[model samples]
Structures are given as structure tokens and as C-alpha cells.
Target: MVQAQDASEEAGTEASGGDEAAEDAQAMMTDESAIDDQAAREFFTSGSNLYSLGRYHDAALQFQQAYDLSERPALLYNIYLAHRDASEHAEAAVALRLYLEATPDADNHAALTVRLENLERGLAEQEASRVSAATAAEEAVRQEQAERERREAEERALAEDDKNIIPWIIAASGGAVMAVGVVTGIIALGLASSLDENCEPAVDGVRFCPSDPSLELENKQSALSTFAVMTDIFLIGGGVIAAVGLTWGLVRLGGAEDDEDAPTVSAMCGPTGCGASMRMGF
Candidate 1:
């Protein structure tokens, strides 16, 4: 009975020694992990100092190496700073968003808040300025189009006015020519009547020349002269009608032109050279 009790006690002591050895191993691993974390932190601080002094590339390398060993949120924030100093805005924004997500409560909360607000405000202002510029460009395009249309319309109106004037001028000239031709015909007819009367035979039934030709031609001459005068009067009346018709047609065509094209607004600048132009069209 005494030997059995002694063997059981020895077995219990061995189990306790084994348990202590396992605990000591775990403690050593914990200490090693803490030391590694401290080293990483020191490397990150050194990189941050370099970045502040404008050594961005070196800082990025250090932060990158530290991150490879341990993916800590604070180290990611340092990586963001290095990227920002190097003018890598896209990469910096990406890293910063990730870091903020990991640790929303960093040590420098007030400074972080101010920086975030400033970045947001700057981005918003830039967007607003871009929108305003776009709107201005659109307005300029619209104004140019309107001006082109107005100029085109003015040319059309001028062409139409010229068209109206040309027909009137042609008609008036044609009427004047017709009047001259009719007057000439009347003069020719009168001359022909005078010649025919002067050369007529005295005895009409026998068709023989009279002894006194002057007495024989007097009546025939008078009748031919009367016919010539009548022709001249009719030609004069036709000429007058043609002239009136031409004038009336031209006046009516002129009235039919667009009213909006009558008035124009124009702008000029400088002493000798002109600047921008502005015009209005109905």
C-alpha cells in the first residue's frame, strides 16, 4: 500500500512540471512578438521623420518593409503620408481610406479631422469650379450659334431685297425702251403717210396722172397725217401704262420683305481695332 501511494505522487509531480514548461514557452513567444512590434514601430517613426523632411521615396520603402512584417493600421497611415508627399494622390487616398477603416480612432484625431475636412472641401470646390466652367463653355457655344444664324438671316434678307430691286429696275428700263420704240413707230407712220399722199395719181378710176398733182394729193395727205397722229397718241398711252405697272410691282415686292431684318444691333470696341461683336435678330 505504501509503494503504490509513492508512485502516484511521483506521477502527479511529473505532470505539474510538464505544465509549467508549456506555460514558459508560451510566455517567451509572447515576449518575442512584443519586441518585434516595438522594432516595427521604431522603423515607422524614422520613416515618418524622413517623409516630413521631403525624403518621400526612402520613407515609402521603410513603411513598405514594416508593413511586410506586420500589417498594422498605424503603419498604413504612415504609408499614406509617404505617398502623399510623393504627389501620388490616387495611391495616397486609397491607403488613407483603408487605414481609417481599420482604426477609426487614431491618436491625432483633431488634426486628422481638420485634414479630412479640408480635403473634402477642396474636392467639392474643384468640382463646382469645373461645373461652372462647363456651363460657361456651353453658353459660349450657344451664343456663337445664335450669332451665325443671325448673320445668315441678314444675308438672306439682303439677297431678297436685292432681288426685289432688280426686277423693278429691269421693268422700268423695259417700259422706257418700249415707250421709245412706240414713239419711233408713230413717227415712221406719219412720214409714210406724207410720202404716199405726195406721190398719188390725180385720176383714180383711170389710174392716170393729173395735170396738177398738188391739187390731187392734198386730201389724201390730210387723211394719212390724221392716221399718223392717232398712232402716236395710242403709243404714248401704252408707254405710260407700262411705266406705272413696273413701279407698282416693285413697291409691293419691297413691302413683302421680312420686317425683322430692317433693324440691326452691333457692337464695337477699342480705338482702331474691334473686340467682341453682339447682334440681335427677331
Candidate 2:
């Protein structure tokens, strides 16, 4: 009977120990949960104080820390509200997106959807602004290219006209005039030649020729012949001078004509007009 009483006592002690251990574990778990809840409450209280002080960015940070600790959708939504109040639209959008992901079927689904739509609209506005800027830049480049092409075409056309048409006309006209003057001078030279042949001849066989009376007459005739030869020489020289003068005049006139006919481009680039005129060889 004493052994049976001792065995019952041992079993009762084991049962009491087991129940105390279970209660201790339960109390530990409760204490840990209370510590976590206190930490979360502290964070939420700090965040609410910052929000009341109008320090939305600081409030958002505090709320984000509370959400990290508690994993509460309400805490995340408070973070989003603080971010929005701070005018940090991007941060607000991110925070809201996180909240929506956490609680898709929460009570405020319509409000979250409206916030996402506004964020999307802001993103769309940013995209449109970028596109407009790019299009304006492209249009400016195209306009500059077109203007350059137009100026180049105008310069090329002016150069071609100067090279091909006007120079040819001036050269041909000058050449024709020079040829006519040369032919007329040659005819005059032939007439002078015939006159010289008829007027001056010396007879070597006759002692006294009555037709050509004296040496004085012969001297006069020789002087006249020399004068005629000098006149012919002067005429030939004058004709050559005239022909050269004509060619020079033609070249100068052609230059003037080119200046007049070509389109004048104004330039502010220093002296010599910045090569606006064509350099055609005369």
C-alpha cells in the first residue's frame, strides 16, 4: 500500500510538471506577441504623430516600418496616404500598388482602382511629353536639311548658267567682230600695195628719162613711197590694237553681264563677298 501511494504521487508530479511546462510555453508565446504588438503600436503612433505634424515623408517612412513589422494592409495604405500627401506621386503609386497586391479584395477596392488610374494617367502624360519633344527635334532637323538643300541647288544652278550660256555668247560675238575688222584691214593693205607698185619704179637703162625728170623728183617720189609704207604699217598696227581692244572690251562686258545676270546673294562674311560670285576664267 505504501509503494502504491508513492507511485501515484510520482504520476501526479509528472502530470503537474507537464501542465506547468505547457502553461509556461503559452505564456512565452503571449509575451512575444505582446512585444510585437507593442512595437507595431509604437511605430503606428510615431507615424500618426509625424502625419499630424504635416511631415508626410517622415510619416510615410514610419508607416512603412510599421507595415514591415505587422504585415498589415491598413498600415501600408496609411503609408500610401502619407506619400500622396507629401506630393511624392511616384512613391505613392508604388506604395499603393503594394497595398493592392496585399489586399486585392479589400473593402476599398474602388478607391485603390481610382488611385491606380490616376497614376497611369500621369505616366501617360509623361510619355506624351517625351514623344512631343522628340518629334519637335526631328522636325527641326528636317527643316534645316531642306534649307541647306535649297541653297545648294540655287548655287549649282547659278554656276551652271554662268558656265554654259553667257560666256559662249560673248566669245562668239567678239570673235566675229575681230574677224570682220581683220578682213577689212587686209583689203586696205592690198589697195596700198597696188598704189605703191604704180607710183614708184626706177629705170636703170636710160641716161636721161624725160618722163621721170630729175633726182629731186625721184627723191620726192621715194619720200612719198616711204610715207605710203609707213601709213600701211600704221594702219596694220592700229587694226591689231583695235582688235585687241575689242577682245578686252568684250571680256569686260561679259564680266559685267555676268554680274548683272547672276542672282546676287547677300553675305555678311567679310570682304570678297565670301565667294558668292562664280570664278569663271575670262
By lDDT, who's the top model here? Answer: 2
TM-score of 1: 0.46
List, residue by residue over 9-86, the lDDT tens digit for candidate 1. Answer: 111222365598876676677677766666666666667678778998788777877665567666777777788788
- Candidate 2 per-residue lDDT, tens place, 103-204, comes to 889887888789788886897798899999999999999999999999999999898666555544544554554555455556545544544454544343
Model 1 residue pairs with clashes: none
Itemize residue pairs with steric clashes in candidate 2: none
Q: Please identify model 2 stretches exceeding 4 Å from their true place.
A: 1-91, 105-107, 166-173, 176-282
Clashes of 2: 0
Best model per TM-score: 1
Candidate 1 deviant stretches above 4 angstroms: 1-72, 86-94, 186-190, 193-198, 201-282
* Count of clashes, each model: 0, 0
C-alpha RMSD by candidate, in order: 19.4, 17.5
Poorest lDDT segment (10 consecutive residues) of candidate 2: 1-10
